[model samples]
Every structure is written in C-alpha cells, then in structure tokens.
Target chain A: MDLRDLWAESLAGMLARPVRSALTTLGTVLGITTLVVTLGIAATAGNQIVGRFDELLATSVTVDVPPSSRGPLVSWDAPGELRRLRGVVSATALAQNEESSNLVVTANNLLDPTRVFGQTLAVVAAGPNLPETTHGRLLAGRFYDAGHVARHDRVVVLGEQAAAMLGITRLDHAPAVFINDRAYTVIGIIGDLRRERVLASAVLVPPTLGPDFGLKDVTRVLVATQLGAAELIARQAPLALSPSNVGELQVIAPAGPRRARDGAQDDVNGMFLILGLVSLVVGAVGIANVTLVTVMERVAEIGLRRALGAGRRHIAGQFLLESSLIGLTGGVIGASLGMAAVVGVAAVRQWTPVLDIRLALAAPVAGALVGLLAGLYPALRAARMEPVDALR
Target chain B: MPEPVIELTGVCREFPSDPPVRALSDVDLRVEPGDYLAIVGPSGSGKSTLLNILGLLDRPSSGSYRLDGVETTELRDGARTRLRGARIGFVFQSFHLLPHRTVVENVMLAEVYGPHPRRGRRARAEQALEQVGMGHRTGFAPGRLSGGERQRVAIARALMARPALLLCDEPTGNLDSRNTEAILDLFDGLRAQGLTILVITHEDGVSARAGRRVRIGDGLLTEQG
Candidate 1:
C-alpha cells in the first residue's frame, strides 16, 4: 500500500478505540515532556547562574604587590594607568603601617581607653577617596580631604571595628589617639565594607606618613570592574603597571567563562538525562502492553481482514502504524508541554529562557521510534494468528 | 461450456486431535460460470469446511483445488491473499460488517487495503450498494441498520470488487421470512444477470431456491436429481 493508504488505515484504527489510544499515548507524552523540560531548564538555569557568577565574582580583581626593602617597591601613583582602562570602575594603591604593629592606642590621649574595646593594629595610609573606592560607608564624622594629604595632616579615620575596639563610638569629643608619642585626631569611622572585610581592623592615615615609618612602597592595588571584564583587565593590568617588573605583580582573575558554563550544563543534563531515559523506557513498556491488549481484543476484526485478502505483513503493518501514530501524537504534545514548562519556570524565576532547537525538533521522532520498537512483538503476534482460529 | 470457476479434486480436511476427526473425505466439486448452486447440511456436516477451502480461507489436506484455473493449494500465502482479493466475494451468516464505518464506506473497503488503485473505488462501492438495494441508507452506520439491511451492506461490500464468485454461508439465517424472500428474489435476479453464486444453508426452503442443490452428510456429498 502507498503512504496515503497506510496512514489513513492506521488513523481509522486509532480513532476506532479513542479511549484506549489516548490512555496509551499518555506514557509517551510524560516521557518526552521530562526529556524536553530537563534539557530546557538546564540551559536556562545554567545561563542564570553564570550571570550571577560574573556579577559578584568576576567583577572584583585584586592585584597584590610584594613589599621591598630597596627604596620603594611600587610607585605611589601606580593605579593611574589601570584606572584609565575600560571596564575598570575604580583602582587605588594602599600602604599598611608595619612599624606601628606593637604600638598602643588610647582615645583623648588616655594612657589606655579603660572603657574597653581596644587592640594594637597596623595603621594604613590611604588617598582622599579611600572610603569611596573601598566600598565602605562613613558612619560618623567626615573623611579627610585632599588638603589633608597635600598638607601632610596628621588626621585619622578609624575603621568600624577599630573605633569600637578602641572604646570610642562617638565623634562629639573629636577623639585623638597617640601612636609612637604622636597625637592624630580621629575624623571619621568607616564600615559596611563591600570589597575587603580585613580593612575594618586598620586605622587610616595620609600616604606621606608612610616614609617616616619605612613603609615607602604600597602593598596592593584593588581594582573594581564591570561584569564580564575581569579576564581582559587581568591580562592588561600587569602590562599597564610597571611593564619592566610585571613579574613582581600578581593579578588574580575569575575562572574561565567557557569552563564554568560547560561545568554547569553538564552537571544539570547528566543527572536529568538518565531519569528521562528511564521514563521513556517506562513509556515504551506501557505502549507494548496497550498494543498487545488491542491486538487481543481485535481478533475477530483481524480474521475478517485476513479473510478479505490482507497478507500477514499487512496485518503487522496496520498495528505498527497504529502504535507509531499514537507515539507521534504523544511526542508532539509532550514537547510542547516541556517547552511551556521551561518558559514558564524561567518567567516565574525572572530568568532568560535558553532552549535548544535541536532537542525540540528531535523529540517527536524519538517518541515515534520508541513506539515503533515497542509495537514490534505485538504486531508480529497479530500477523501470525491463524485466520480460521481467530474467526472461531 | 466454460471451464469451471472453481474445481476441487480428492479434497480431504482433517482436524488433528487425539482421535483425528475427519471433517471432509475425498470430496470432488465443480462450479462453472453463471452457476447458482446450494449445499445443504446439518451442523458438523463439513459443508462449511468445503466452503472455506473454496473461499481460500483454509487449505485442504492432500487435495488439489483450483480457482479460475490457478492452482491455489500450492500458492504462497501472499499470492493466495491476492487471488482471494481479486476473485472471491464472501457473505458470512453473521453479517460481518465493520460497525464503525458508514454503509458506503464499508462497501468501499474492497480497495482500501487491496492493491487496486483507488481511482474509481467510491463510484463502484456506490453502484454496488444500489445493486443490493441499500442505496437509500448509504450514509448510515451498520449498527443503525436492521439485520437484513446490514447483511445487504455486507453483500454490497463483497460485490464492490466484482469478483468472479459470490460465496454465501447461511445468507438468510438471521432474516425473517419476509426479508428472506426478498433476499432470495435479489439472488435470483443476480443469477439472471449471469453471475456465479454459491449458497450454503441448512434451511430446505433456502436451498430449494437455487437451480442446483447438493447434500453433505457424515463427510460425504450426494447430488440432488
């Protein structure tokens, strides 16, 4: 028979037992739906996770420079070239007061702030915009200005914890602390850090004070960037800053984007793909059971067709086509359902849906193949029936 | 005289059992073109077995059966199916109509699964329905029809292919006397049109309507004078 006749005949048979056909098709629908939803959501979720990773992790790069005893290790204006690069939001050079490590601090020049909360920590030399560049909030009092740095003012701003550690919480007294027998006024307190939490334990000073403490060179440069620009900045930062001694600078960037994306998708697809296959096998078994029952129920009809001159192969072909048609219908419905589920989930979670076109296109064919294979034994049994016996 | 449309020689059909029951024994039969014949028998008399062999629905053990000069007993299963499709029309006692389809569609099934091109299938099916006097209810499903009407539709389905033989087993078994007389009249008209017809029935009145009659009993057959 031609394609037209074969399809028509199968369609008629399927329509004859509409309830049975629908029930049998449900298995394939669920199976294919699982597969499509699994892959689609993997792509969608993978894309969203990578986006977050880029935002929080890839955008922050820290370039650490080692300390040197030979004059100065890095220029005081080392961030000038890096700050001009695209995607770089802010860059700054910083120096810690290593010589003041053992010094005691007290508010209002008290021998020791007996109210509590005190520690002997290093003092840091910072620029005028240190609080802003470091993503810290000023809780009380104002930070020192450029006039302080240019005039070599002996002013200080305690970190959040440092102020508390010194038992000084208020700015009303215009608190002053003595280090190495020199008095410096605490102008402000900085806290709520976004970049570095370790900065909270340190006090702040002008860069000019570094020379007196033998802290002539800065320790590290911190650079904040736009999303997805870390790799490029990591590659170009060393070249831009002291190209002659780029080896002494260490640029730490985020993990590779391609590797992260693959790692994410493979993890999602691998776990769900096995579950989807199991569902599909269950669907195939359901089809085989339903098709075998249908064959048994249609014995008299089969005898009639055989008596009307249908060959054994024709009998087999009819049942096979019936099952494949059922599978095709299920596949179409399941694929649509899977796509809708993915899109709906993405919409609910506010994620951009990423669907693989090839998976969508192949689901129906795979369902039909599964159905065809499942119907083989049943169709054979139907074909091998004896016309006289079936009629009897 | 034209060569017989069906010929059976030394035909024997035996069911394999612990006791080996013989359904038919060395039966010889011939049916020529335009012949109207009936074989009358009680239940279990082997008349239906003979009809099955003639209809190519069953094979006769140790026999040579030919349909339209084709050696059918030696033919392959596929070739037998093709031959049956092209040459034989069957009417079962139970009115074996596919209840899901309309009467006209049931008739058109002659070419639905067969090798015949579907070019003029509908027209032939419609004409065949008219021939069986079922034209008025062409669109009705077989389930909605009366027993006689359903049988007529089945007959129309058989006739749509215009086979060389019309083989009916208990054609009027389920019909009332009124419907049976009408069917017998239609059969008479068809025989007058030079169609070869075979009717197998246990009813004496049904067999008496045919031009030739044969009696089958205890696996043997005898002709009526």
Candidate 2:
C-alpha cells in the first residue's frame, strides 16, 4: 500500500477504539513531558545559580600579604597601583594590628560613670575604597576617603555588628567610640558585606593609622573584578603590587564560574534525564503492550487481510505505522505540556525560564522512535501467523 | 479451447496429527470459465480442505494445481498472494464484512492489495455494489445491514477486483430461507454474466441450484450424474 493509504488505515484503526488509543498514548505523553520539564528547569536553575556565583564569589579576589620587616611589605599606595590592572573593578588594602583584639573598646570612657561598656574587637585599617571592594554600603554617615587618610584624621567606620554593640544607631550626633582610651569619630556604619563576613563586626580605620595601631605591614589586598575576570586579575594582581616579591602575595581567587556552572548543570541534567528516560521506557512499554493486545484481538482481521492478498510485510507495516503515529502524537502533546509546566514553575518561582530549541524540536521524533521500537515484537508476531490458523 | 480457470491433478493434503489425518486424497478437479459448480458435503467431509487448496490459502502436500494456467504449487508466498488477489474473489459464510466500514469502503478493500490502479476505486466499488443490488446501501455500515444485505455487500467486495473466479463457502449458511433464495438468484444472475463460480455447501437445496454438482465424502470427490 502507498504511504497515504497506510496512514489512513492506521488513523482509522486508532479512531475505531479512541479510548484505548488515548490511554496507550498517555504513557508516552507523560514521559516526554517529564523529559522536557526536567531539562528546562535544570537549565533555568543552573543559570540562576551561575548568575549568583558570578555576582559574588567569582568576582571577589583576596591577596594575603605576608608580614615583612621592611617597614611595610607593600606600600600604602599599592591598592591604587593594582586598581590600574585590567579587569580590576575596585581594590583596597587592609592592615590589622595583631594586638588590636586585646585592646578593650568601650562606648563610654572610664570618666563617664553613668555608662561603662567595654568589648574587645579586632581593629582593621583599610584603604578609602573599602566599601566598594567589600561589596558593602554605608548605612549611616559617609565613608572615610583619601582626604581623611592623607590628613591622618582620627576617624573610623563601624561594621554593622560593631555599631550595634556600641549602641550607635545614627550619626546625627557623631558618636565616639574609645579604643584603649583613645577616642575616634565614627564616620560611617557599613553593612551588607558580601565578600568578607568578618568585616561585618570589625572596626575599620584608614591605612594611615596602621602604624599608630601597631599595624606596620599591609596585611591583605581585597580586589573585585568584572564577571569572568577574577582569574586574570588574580594572576596579575601580585605582579602589579610588588614586581620583586610576587610570590610573597598569595592570591585567593575562586574557581572558574563556567566550570562550576557546567558541573552543576551536568549533575542536574544527568539525574533528571534518567527519570525522564525511565518514564519514556514505561510509555514505550505501554505502547508495546497495547499493540500486542491489539494484534491478539485482531487475529481474524489479520486473516481477512491475508485472504484479501496482503503479504506478511504489509500486515507488519500497518501495525508498526499505527504505533509510531500514536507515539508521535503523544510526543507532541508531552513536549508541549512539559514546556508549559517549566514556564509555569519558573513563573511561580520568579525565575527566568530557560528552554533549548533543539530539545523542543526533537521530543516528538524521539517519541515516534520509542513507539516504533515498542511495536517491533507485536508487528512481527502479527506477521508470523499462518493465514489458515488465523482464520480458524 | 480456452485454458480452464482451475486444473488440479493428484492433489493431496495431509494434517500431521498423532497418526496423520488425510484431509484430501489424490483429488483431481477441473473448472472452466463461466461454469457454476457446487461441491456439496457434510461437516468433516474435507470439503473445506479442498476449497482451501483451490483458493491458494493452503498448499497440497503432493500435487500440482494450476490457476489460470499458472502452476501455483511452486510459487512463493508473495507471488501466490498476488495471484490470489488478482485472480480469485472469496465470499465467506459469515459475510466477513468489516462492520466498522461503510459498504462502499468494504467493497474497495478488495483492490487494496490487488494489481489494480488505486484511482477511481470508489467508483468501481459503487459499480460493484450496484451489480449486486446493494447500490442503495453503499454508504451504510455492515452492522446496520440484514444478513442478506451483508452477503450482497460481501459479493460486491468479491467482485471489486474483477477477479477471474468467485469462491463461495456456504454463502447462504447465515441467511433465512427468503434471503437464501435472494442470494441464489443473485448467483444465477452472476453466472449468466459469464463469471466462473464455485460454491461449497452442505445444503442440498443450495447445491441443486448450480449447473454442476460434486459430492465429497471421506477425503474423496465423486461426480453427480
């Protein structure tokens, strides 16, 4: 028979038992739907994770400076020099006095008998660009800048937790905190430190006061780069800081975001792809089972066809075509349902939905292939029956 | 002298049972074009076996049978099937009409596997239905038709390929007496049109209507003088 007639025959056969055909096709539909939804959600979730990684960990680079006996291991102007390097968005140097943690910090001095509060907090001196490098914002008052550092102004920025402990909420009256009986004006309260959580509780001062605080060496340099630029900056920052002692600075750059993203995506894809395939197999089994049962039920019809001069191949072809058509139909519907489910989930979760066009295009074909494979044994069985026996 | 529609010589068919049952034994038969012949026998008389061998649905264990002068015993399955489709039409006792299809569609199925061109198949089916006096019921499904009407539809299907021979197996077995008479009359009309016909039946009344009658018993065929 011609392809057109074969297709018509298959359609008529399916229409003859609509409910059975639809139930059989549901298995394939669910399989394809699961496949599409899993892949789409995996892509979207992987994208979201990678985006967050790029924004925070991937862009931030830290260089630990070993203490040196020669005044300071690096100059106070080292941050400015490193900022000129390619991919460096912001750079800041910090020097922490080793004994600052031992010093007692009090919101009120001993002379004030009304309120006496003391706490031992680490004191860190940083460059004027500390806010930008730390990915922090000044919640209250202004941050100390180059002018304040150049002038050696006794000013300090309180970390969010530090300010809370010091009982300082606003800068309306310019609160003063005493460190070892030396008072310094709190210029700003910084919060939302994305890179260094330690900075959220430390007292930050300018690098100019490092010597006064017994912090003679610049301890570390914090650098932030653009997305996908952290590794390049990590390699170049040491050279830019001190050409003679690049090894002295240990750069701590995060692993590549692309690799991490792909790793995460692959893991998700691998896990859920199996589930999709299992569902698809189940669907294929359903098709095979229904096709087999149909072959069994139509023995007399098969005999009739044989008597009407259909060869074994023609009988087999008709059945195979019928199953494949059912699978193709299920695949289309499943793909559509899966995509809709992905979009619906993403919408509810407030995520950007990601879908592959190629996957969308291939789902129906895959379903048809599954159906074709599933129909093999049953079609062959139908073809193998002796015409006389079948008629009997 | 034209070639006979069928020629069988020493045709024997055996069923391998615990002790082998011979269904047909050294059967020889000849049928000419435009001949209305009947093979009458009771059940278990091997009449069905003879019909199966003649219809090319089964092969005789040892013999030579030719249809339209072509040796059918040595033909491959596909070639045999093609030959059957092109040259022989069948009418079953049960009518064997596809209940899901319209009368015209059932008729059109005859040429679906035949050597006939597919174009204008519906027109040919309609013409065949008209020839069998089932023209008015061409659009009706077989389930809606009476036994007689269904048999007529089956006859239309059998004639669709313009086959050289019409093979009937108890064609009136399921029909009432009136319906049986109607089918017999239709067969007479078909035979008058120069169609070669063979009918297998157990009913004496049905066999008496044919021009030539043969009785089969115990795997043997005998002519009725």
Candidate 3:
C-alpha cells in the first residue's frame, strides 16, 4: 500500500467525524501545553539563579572573622598575605566607618558621600587598572588618579543609582550626603554594573581605617586574580591566610557573561526536552484510543475493503495514517500553546524566558512518535480483523 | 468465456448450534461468466448461508469450492481474503453504506479494496456510481438518501472493484416495487456485460428476473429452474 493514499483516506475519514477527531486531539494539546508551561517556568527560574551567581561574585573568596575563632581576625595583614599567594594579582582591605566618611567631588558637579571606604586611598594608586565593577561603572569623575590615592584624598564617586537618588542630576554639580551624621561631598557618579542587585545604594572606600569606627580590622578584602587564574587564586588564598579566626571564608570565581548565558541555555534546553517527552506520551495514548475506536466502528468497512482486495498492510496503513494526523495536529497546537504559555507566564512573573532551539526541534518529533506508538495496536487489530465476521 | 466463473462440489456448511445446524448441504452449482443465478429460500432455509459461502465470507464445513479456477477451500485466510477482495462484490439487502461517508466515499471504499491503490480509487468509485445513475448524488451521505438510493449506492460500491462475481443478499428485500425494478434492471445490464451475478432472495419477482433460479430448503438444494 502506498503510504500517501493511506494518509489521504485516513485524514478524510477523520474529518468525517469532526467532533470525535477534534476531541481526541484536544487531549494531546492539553498534555503538551502542560509540558511546555512547566518546563518554561522552570527554565526561567534557573536562568535567574545563574545570573544571580555573578552578582554574588561566585568566584570571589570572602574572609570574615568567625565568632568561634580565637584570634583577632580583623587586620591589614590579610590583604598583604593574600596578594603574595600564587594566583593573586592584588588585594585591598575594606573597612566601614560611620564617621570620617565624606563625599568626594571632582571637576564634575557630581557628589557622592557613601562611596568612601574609610581607609588610605593607596589602593587607588593602582589607578584605572583596578577591576571595574561588573555590575556598575564610573559615569563622570575620573576614578581616584594616582595623586588622589597617594595623598589619601577623601574623595568618592557615587554609582549611577546612588547619584540619582542623591539628586546629583547635573554632570558638573556636586551633591552632598550625611553619613553617620557626618556630611561629605559627592565627587562623581558611577554607571550601572554588568549585574547589580540594588543600583542606588553603593560606596567606594579606600583600603585602610581597619580599626576606625569600631572596625577592629578589615571586614572584607577584595582580591583580583590574574586572567584565567581566578579559580586557582581563590583556591590558594585560604591556605596562605590560614587564620583560625576567619569565619566561613568562601572562595568564589566570578564568572563572566558567557557562563551565565550557558547556564541559562542549558536549563531552558533541558526543560523543553522533558516537556516534549511528556507531551508526546500523552498524544500517543490519545491516538491509540482513537484508532482502536476507529477500528471497532469501521469493522464492516474494513471487511468490505478486504473483500475488495485490500491487504492487511493496506488496512494497517489507513488506521496508522489516521492516528499520525491526529498526533501532528496536536503537536502543532501544543507547540504554539507552549510558546505562548512561556511568554505569558514570564510576562506575569516579570522574568525573561528564553526560547531554546532544542525545544523548537523537539516538538514535531515528539508529536509524530506519539502518533505512531499510539496507532500500533489498533493498526494490528485492524489488519487481523476477519473479513467474514467483520461484514456481519 | 466458456469456463464457469463459480463452481461448487459437495459444499456443506455447518454452524455449531445445540444440534450443530447445517447451513448448506451437498450443494453443487456452476455459473458461467455472464450468468445471473438466484438462490431462493426461507430465512432458515440457507439462502443467506449459500450467499455467504459463495462470497468467500465464510468457509463450508466440508466442500471443494472453486472460483475463477482457484480451489478456495485449500487457501489460507489471507489468501481467501485476497481472493474475496479481488473477485467478490457484495450488495446487502440493508445497503450497509457507512453512514458517515458520502455516497461517493462509500463507493470509493470498494475501489480502496480493489486491485488499484487508493490513488485511483476515487475515479473508479465515481465511475461505479455513474454506472448506477448515482453520479449526481455522489456528495450526499447515505443517511440522507432513500432506501432505494442507498441500495443503488451499495450496488455501485460493489461494482467499483469490477469483481468477477457479484453477490446480492436480498437486494430488494427493503425496497418498494419501483425501486426493486430499478435494481433488477441494473443487474440485468451488469449480466449483459459478462459478469457472473448470484442473488439471494425470497421475493418471487426478484428470482423471476434471473437467468436461472435455485431453491434451498432446510440447508438442502431442492430444485432448479
């Protein structure tokens, strides 16, 4: 039997029973829709998590004084020790003090007080070569030049959100802020980071004042590693600075955009595959049931066709085609619904749901397979029907 | 042209009832190409039984039946099915046209089973409908047609395969006289085209139109005319 004719006749027969055929396909569509929506939502959540990894500095190692540790953990010694480690490029100690924190002003009118790190600005002597904030950038004032760092200038630059919040709207205008009841002038405002949690609240401080404002020692040390050596550097720092007082010191290798993109891609892809499989199974069951009923209802017709010279293969082909058509139609509807659901849910949840190429490739394949699997039993039964008994 | 299209020798069909009823007994019959034969009997007298056997729809308990020179009793189920599909066309009294299909589609079903694939089945089906003067009613569903019209469509469907033998079981049992005559006329025309036709009926008028008539009573061949 030519498969084409079988397909034609089967489709025509199904169209003849529009209501039953439509209802049968509806089952598959619902199944596919559920699969798509579930996968899409999961993928969206996964992408967000991966993106958050960068903001939290997944590759950066944190050194903190644990309450259980015996020694005085806060000090300027950690940065120097960490910098000497094999992969470490440079290390800067950061201390937070409520007083002596003043807003820094540059040639621009931008003013930022909270940017003060309350330490010797010597770290700024590293100049622009210092690591750029992945989540934000300097917009107006030049970062503390070598002169400003050597002199321990009380200048600071505000992040874009902080500057805007502080009403430092004009480029040449210096805005002032109150820090721990002390007033400081804003020097300049920085722009957005590659990834930022809250843009409007930020500060740039120097690497000293470890003992000032109740800060007995350095609370945090920002360490930059050589290119491609972030992970290696993070790994070596703990052993090099093995101090008993460090609390929950974690090593994080800050990942770039590529890693985040790959993670998002993987999550979206995996979910779509799972959803595709689920939809296909449901479609197959529907197809099988429909074919079985079709065989039962058309027993006499089958008999007549056989008596007219149709072989078992012919009968099988016809029924198989019918089921395949149902599957294909359901697949199309399911795919469309799936995409829509993803978009809709993303919009509602305020998430970005990416469309993965793998999902696009899987929908049709799943639909077709379901059709074939579902039709197998019914086609066999139709082929085996007795011409004599069937006509009765 | 000289050979008999259907031949039977000592054909006996039995149904396992409480007493194992015999539906056909020692039936010997022959029909040349173009012959119109009618078998008439009461409901339980085995007329339908003979039709079923001749249609290759059922096997006789013990008998050697030949159709178009093939010994049917020795054939496998698949072979028998193929033979039945290729050689036999049935027109039931009830005109069992699929209710969901259009008249043309019903006729096309015959071509679907014919030697041709489904590709050319439609044209043959339409041609068969035209033969029965049902060309215009091709789009109408069987449920929408009258009893006579439905039977004609069934006849067209039977003819669509161009079978060597046409088996009609009470073709006019459900039709009025005028519709009955129309069917009988079509049978006559088909017979003139050198087709072997076997019709089973209780109606005397239907039997009278055949070239030869046989009577069965209680599963036994009783007479011939």
Candidate 4:
C-alpha cells in the first residue's frame, strides 16, 4: 500500500479509542512542557540578570595602592599613562589626608556649636576623573577638572548626599565646606554613583590641596573600563601604576558579564536537563506499555489482516506510525503550553522574555523520535506473530 | 488452457506435539473457476488443516501449493502475502469484523492492504457492500449489527478485494437455520457468477449445499460426491 493510505489506517486505529490515546499522549506532553519551560526561563532570567551585572559590576575595577612609608606607590602622572591603554575609560587615584580622618566636615560656618549640618563625612583627595570612574553625574556645576588640580585652587565637589545634609544646593553661589578648621570651595555635586555607592556622601577635592591637610600617599585607584574589558584591565592596572611593586596593590575586578551569563545559562540547563530526560523516559515507557497492550488486544484482527495479505513490515509500520503521531501531537501541544508559561512568567516578573527558536522547532522532532524508538519492540513483536498461531 | 484457481500437491502439516501429530499427509486438491467445494469431518479430522493450507495461512511441512498459477511454497513472506491478498478472501464463522470500525470501514480495510492504496477506496468498498446486500448498514459498527447482518458485512469485506477464491471456515456455524439458509443463498449467487469458493465445516447440512463434497478423516482426503 502507499504511505498515505498506510498512515490513514494507522490514524483511524488510534482514533478508535480516544481516551486511551489521550492518556498515552499525556506523558509526552508533560516531558516536552518541562523541557521548554526550563530552557525558556533559563534564557530569560540569564539575559535579564546578566545584563544588569554587565552594566554595573563587570565594567569597573578597583586597585588598592599601599603607602611605601617614604614615597608614594604610584605617581600623580600614573592616570595619564594608564588612560592611553586600550579600554580604559577613566582612572583616578583616591587618598585621604592623615590628619582629616578625625576632623568633622561641615558645609556652613554657623557659629552655634549645638547645630550640625555636614559632619562625619569623609573628605577625599582625587585626581580629575573621579566622577567618570565612579559612573556618577554632576547635578550642579562641573567637577573640578585638571586645571583646578594643576592650579592647586583648593576647589572641592560635594556628593549629592553631603550637599543635602549640609543644605548646599546650587553651585551658582560656589558654597564652601570646612574640614576641621580649613575651608575648601564646593564646585559641584556628584550623584548616581553606580559602583562604589559610598562615594555619594563624601567630600571630594583635587590632590594638589591634600598635602596641607596631612594627606600622604594614594590609597585607592578607581578604574572604569569599557564593557567586557575589566579582566584585562584588572591584570594590567597594578603593573601600570607601580612598575616594581605590582603585588602590593590588590586589583578587585568582578567577573565579566558574558562569563556570568553563560555560567548562569549552563547551570540552569544542567539542572533542568535531568528533569526533562526523566520525564521523557516516563513518556517512552508509557508509549511502550500502551502499544504493547494494543498489539495484545488486537491479536485476532492482526491475524485476520495477516491472513488477508499484510506482511510483517506492514504490520510493524502501522504500529510505529501510530506511536509517532501520538508523540508529535503531544509535542505540539506541550511546546505551545511551555512557551505560554514562559511568557506569562516573564510578564509577571517584568522581564523581556528570551526564547531560543531552535529549541521550540526541535521539540516535536525529538518527541517523534522518542515515539519511534519506544514502539520498536512492540511493533516487532506484533510483526513476528505467525498467522496460524495468532488465528488460533 | 485455463489455470486452476487453487492447486495443491502432496501437502502435509505436522503439529510438533510430544508425538508429532500429522494433521494432513500427501493431500492433493484442485479447484477451478466457478467451483463450489466443501470439505467436512468431525473434530480431530484434517479438514481444518487442509483448509488452512489452501488459504495460504499455514505453510505445509512438505509439498507444493500453487494459488492462481503461482508456486507459493518457495515464495518469500511478502510475495506470498501479496499473492494471497490478491487471490483469496476469508470469512470466519464468528464474523471477524473489527469491533470498533463501521461496516463500510471494515470492508475498505481489504483495499487498504491492496497493492495500490489510494483515497478513492470508499467507492469500491460501498460497491462491495451493495453486492453483499449490506449497503443499508454501511455506517453501523459491528457491535450494533445482528449476527446475520455482521456476517453479511464480513462477506462484503471478503469480496472487496475481488479475490479468485472465497474461503469460508464454518461460515454458518453460529447462524440460525434461517440465517444459514440465507448465507447459503448468497454463497450460491456468488458461485453462479463464476468465482471459486471453498467451505470447511463439521455439519452435514452445511456440506450438502456445495456442488461437490470431500470428507477428511485421520489426515486422509476422500471424495464423497
């Protein structure tokens, strides 16, 4: 018989008992559904969580430069040399004056001792690129530039929180804050520090004016590199800053976002792959059991067909087609349900759903293959039955 | 020079019991077109075995079988099936229609296993049902039909292939005497139209309807009419 007719007959046989067919197909549906859901959520969650990680932590590197007792571990011109390196967005040296560690910082020169506006805030000496390295924005005037540092103009920038605490808003008046008894003019307010959020409440100044307030050596070198460039910059930062004592400086660079994303996807898929496979095994078993029962139940019919003219191959082919069609139907239904579940989850969580189209496309084919393999033993058994024996 | 529809020479069947029981031995039988023959015997006689060998359902332990001028003893499994399907149709006493299929679908099942299967098989099946006087019950499942009606549908299924030989094994065993007479009338009508038919039965009344009668006893064949 032609393949079209053979397939139609097999389909009619399956349709004869609708409830049994539906029950047999359920196992495959659950298997395919689990597979799709696991993969969908893995891709979506990985895309979302890693995207933010790439933006905030993955692109920033911090190097702690220890004081050398007699001389600075890094020179003031180190940032200039490092900026010429590839992928270096900004590099700034941060240091604190030794004597100002215990001094109270204030924004207003109020004579009354009972009131405190800007106190216990850290005062830091920085190079020109402090705002860029921290991924912060100026809410008021521009940050004190190289010109100010070169001129030793004693200019300072207040962090957003520091300015709020001290009641210093607009830099149109050029407000000045005091550390102990010394005054430094505030030229700008830095806000939105993505990395190193503690800097949003500090008082920032150019390093040229730091020695007078007892500042000695650079303590921290904050570096912001381009996306996916943190690893290389982390390896090279200490060497570039201190040619002889690279080991003394500690470079703290978070892992790359691409790596984190891949790792996350792999982890999620690894865990769920087992569940998918277990479900598929259960499905295969169901197909095998049901197909065997069908063969047993239809012994007389099979024998009569054999007597009429059906060959072994024809008998085997009919049963195999019967199972594969069941699997394909289950796979189609399961895939749609899984995709809907993933989209629903993403919608609830406010994430952009990421789906791999190839996975969806392959599921039905996989299910069909599973059905074919599952039907192999039963079909062979049916085909091998002798017409005389079956009829008896 | 017309070829006989069935030709059997020295056919034997041995059931491998502890003491190998010989069901048939050196049996030779021939039936040409328009022949209506019946083989009858009591239980443990070789009538069923002779019928099985003739129907191509069982291979003889030794000897040759030719159905419609083709040597079947040496034919491969698939070729034998095609030869049998094209040349032979069977009707069992129990009316072996698939319990789930409608009468029309049951008849079309023969066409499904035919050499060139296609979509227009329904028309041929309907025509076969009409020939068997079962056209009115085409849409009914076998369970819904009475014994007589189900036997008619089975006959329709048998005739759908246009086989040269209609092999009936106890076709009237489960029928009432009236239904048996009716089925025998249908068989007579079919034989009158030039088809070779073989009936295997244990009842003398059933064997009396055939044009020629043969009795099998203890694996031996003897012509009775």
Docking class of 1: medium
lDDT of 1 by residue, A1-392 (tens): 55687777788888988988898888899989999998999889888878877765667777778865554556777776778899887777787645754456666544444455335777777666776666789999988887888898888888888888887788888888767667888899999766777778777777876665555677777777787788898888877776777888898877866678888889888878888888888889999999999899888878778877788998899999998988888888889999999999999999999998898889988889888999999999999998777666
Binned by DockQ into CAPRI classes (incorrect, acceptable, medium, high), candidate 2 is medium
Q: DockQ rank, highest first?
A: 4, 2, 1, 3
1 or 4, greater by TM-score: 4
**DockQ of each two-chain model:** 0.51, 0.60, 0.49, 0.77
Candidate 3 fnat reads 0.59
> Tens digits of per-residue lDDT for model 3 on A1-392?
45555766788878978888888887677766666665666667677665556444554444443322444454555567776776565665555433423333232333456554232111111122233423345677655544655565555555565555445666565555544434445566667554333323455533331222344444445666655566676666656655543335655456664576566657666766666566557667777887898889889878767767777888888888788778777767887898898888889878788666576557655665678779899999999887777777
Off by over 4 Å in 2: A98-123, A138-148, A153-191, A200-203, A243-248, A262-276, B17-19, B115-119
Higher-TM-score candidate among 2 and 3? Answer: 2
lDDT for each residue of candidate 3 in B66-151, tens digit (9 for 90 to 100): 99989999998778877887788889877878787788988877755445765667777888888988998999988988898999
Best by TM-score: 4
Q: Assign candidate 4 its CAPRI class.
A: medium
For candidate 1, the per-residue lDDT at A214 reads: 53
Q: Rate the local accuracy (lDDT) of all candidates.
A: 0.84, 0.89, 0.70, 0.86
Misplaced by over 4 Å in model 4 are A97-102, A111-118, A169-174, A265-271, B117-119
Query: Please, what's the RMSD in Å of model 2?
Result: 3.5
What interface root-mean-square deviation (Å) does model 2 yield?
Answer: 1.1
**Model 4: per-residue lDDT, tens digit, B170-210?**
99999999888889999999998888889999988889999
The superposed Cα distance between candidate 2 and the true structure at residue A61, in angstroms, equals: 1.7
The TM-score between candidate 2 and the true structure equals: 0.87
> lDDT tens string, model 2, A271-390?
778988998999999999999999999898888788888899989999998899889989999999999998998899998888999989999999999999999999999999988777
Better of 1 and 4 by lDDT: 4
Instruction: Give one digit per residue, the lDDT tens place, for model 4 in A152-210.
Output: 89788888887888888988877888877678888899999768677777788789877
